[model samples]
Target: MDDLPDDALGDVLRRLPPRWLAASRCVCKAWRRTIDERRLLRPDLLPLSFAGIFIQFDSHAFPEFFARPSPSSANTKLDFLP
Candidate 1:
C-alpha cells in the first residue's frame, strides 16, 4: 500500500466502510495524511465531543463562550454584536 500513489490509495480508502477507513488512518502517517487531505471520512459520521457553550445575557453586549483548551477551540472567536 505504501508503494501506491496517493490518488490510487485515496480511491481505495474511499471504498472502505467508515469504520475500516478510520482504522486505516492509524496505519501510518502517509495513510492518515491521504485520508485527511482527501477528506475520505465523513465528519458528521464521526463521534463528536462537547467543545463548549456560548451564553448570551440580555444585559451583556456580547455573548460569552467557554471552551476547553483544545485544538478545535484554539482559533475560535466570537465577533457578533448583541
Candidate 2:
C-alpha cells in the first residue's frame, strides 16, 4: 500500500465511512498525512464540544452546575430549583 500514490490512496480511503477512515489513519504515517491533507475526515463531524456538567452530592439538595462559558450563555440561569 505504501507504493500507491497519495491520490490513488486517497481515492480509496475517501469511499470509506468515518469508522474506517479513522482506522486508516492509524495504518501508517503516509496514509494519515494524506487523510489530513485532503481533509478526508472532517473534524467537525467528531464530537468534541463541551456543553455542561452536573454534579450531585449526598448532602446537597441540588446538583452543582458547570458549563462552558460562551456569549450565548451569558444570560443562562439555573432556575430549576423549586
Candidate 3:
C-alpha cells in the first residue's frame, strides 16, 4: 500500500507527515518540490517535520543504525563490513 503510483504520489505526499515527505524529497527532485510546496502552504506540517527530525536523529544515534547508500556510491565503511 505504501508504494504509490507515480500519478498518485502527490496525494500520498499530502497524507503523509511532512517530515517523512521532507525526507522523501531525497528520493528525487520532483518529490522534493511537491513536498516543499505542500509544507509552505500548510503550517500544520511543521509538527510533522519536527517529529520527522526527531525520529531521524534517534535512528542515526542508535548503535544498530544503517542505511543503503545511493547506487552510485558504494564506498565500504568498517561498520558495514561482514
lDDT of each: 0.88, 0.86, 0.61
lDDT of 1: 0.88
Error of 1 at 57 (Å): 32
Clashes in model 3: which pairs?
A: none
Badly placed stretches (over 4 Å) of model 1 are 51-82
Q: Which run of 10 residues does model 2 get worst, by summed lDDT?
A: 68-77
Number of clashing pairs per prediction, in order: 0, 0, 0
lDDT of 2: 0.86
- Summarize candidate 1's per-residue lDDT along 1-82 as a digit string, tens digits: 6678999988988999999998999999999999999999999977788879988887756889999876664645666646
- Tens-place lDDT per residue, model 3, 1-82, is 3466545877877776656765777887777776676553365554442211222456547544345444677666788568
- Best-fitting candidate, measured by TM-score? 1
**Which regions in candidate 2 have their CA more than 4 angstroms from the true location?**
49-82
Give the per-residue lDDT digits (tens) of candidate 2, residues 1-82: 7588889998999999998898889888999899999999989776576679888876657888899667764755679768
Q: TM-score-based ranking, best first?
A: 1, 2, 3
